[model samples]
Target: MATEATEIEITTIGRRTGEGHSHPVWFIREGKSTFLLPVGGRGSQWFRNLRNNPTIKLGATSAKAKLITDQAKVGQVMDEFSSKYGAADVQRYYPGVDVAVEVRDS
Candidate 1:
């Protein structure tokens, strides 16, 4: 069976140093578009780097430096994220947070 994009966990890169960071982010794919939810908020380096260079290493089994971003389509992806990761407060200090990131699957 082909690997389902939904089943993959993308490993995003850091802003300053291109290091790898893994998080259980929700990914919804349509055509060539993939969406992500950065629950960590401002502390989420993945979101910072992606927004800067839009390049990341998507790692589920292996790794690939693919491009990602955020957009209106995030609402759709956030729905899936809330379903899988649940709508519970992902962060403690900041409640009711719904930050997300949109990326291209590598």
Candidate 2:
């Protein structure tokens, strides 16, 4: 993964349609894991899709996703995002920080 890139395209299977859907999302990489924050938290369409199917694609890289709902863990992921994307920008763009997604290499 390219650490310098600010954003990456994530492809997920639609919960209802069972079809592929791709969207640009901001992410932060730490060691072997990648963290992502849904713009609308658990309510985001992508997040909901992941709940049904954890499989995903970060650009061309296939991966598995785990939803981080624990408050403490989500906070840590949020902090990482703030550190990388700037606090102001994160706060402005991500209003609902109730959940996070952790992506690991497959």
Candidate 3:
């Protein structure tokens, strides 16, 4: 299935342009929800776009995205990412782990 893949494509509407922007991002699927970590934390362009519009498309599936800023909750998600992608890799790629995005199945 798509969820089992290493990465998934997500499309978010541009915060300033109001146009669709797509990017391939690493994700972890837990039950009915998918979690994503911005490589640049909250400074990521896609993440900023999410702040303007929480709606996103995961591959062909449309879903609502929620920004997770709570440190405890973000830590839990980071743990999951570490377990799946390995601790060393997650740290190397995601240096600024200040926030996370949660996308629910739609």
Best prediction by TM-score: 2
Cα lDDT for residue 42, candidate 2: 93
TM-score of structure candidate 3: 0.95
Per-residue alpha-carbon lDDT of candidate 2 for residues 1-106, written as tens digits (9 for 90 to 100): 7888999999999999999999999999988899999999999999999999999999998888999999899899889988999999999999877999999865
Which clashing pairs does model 2 show?
none
**lDDT (10s digit) by residue, model 3, range 1-106:** 3656889999999998999999999999898889999999999999999999998998988888999999998999999999999999999999978999998876
**Model 3: lDDT of residue 4:** 65
Q: Name the regions of candidate 1 deviating beyond 4 angstroms.
A: 1-7, 60-72, 83-95
Residue 82 displacement (Å), model 1: 3.7
TM-score each candidate: 0.54, 0.96, 0.95
lDDT, candidate 1, 1-106, per-residue tens: 1325444556666767767666654465556645555555535677666666665545544333333334444455555665655566323323433455544444
Judging by lDDT against the true structure, name the best candidate.
2
How many clashing pairs does model 3 include? 0
Q: List residue ranges in candidate 2 displaced over 4 A.
A: none
C-alpha RMSD of each candidate structure in angstroms: 4.8, 0.8, 1.0
Clash list (residue pairs), candidate 3:
none
Off by over 4 Å in 3: none
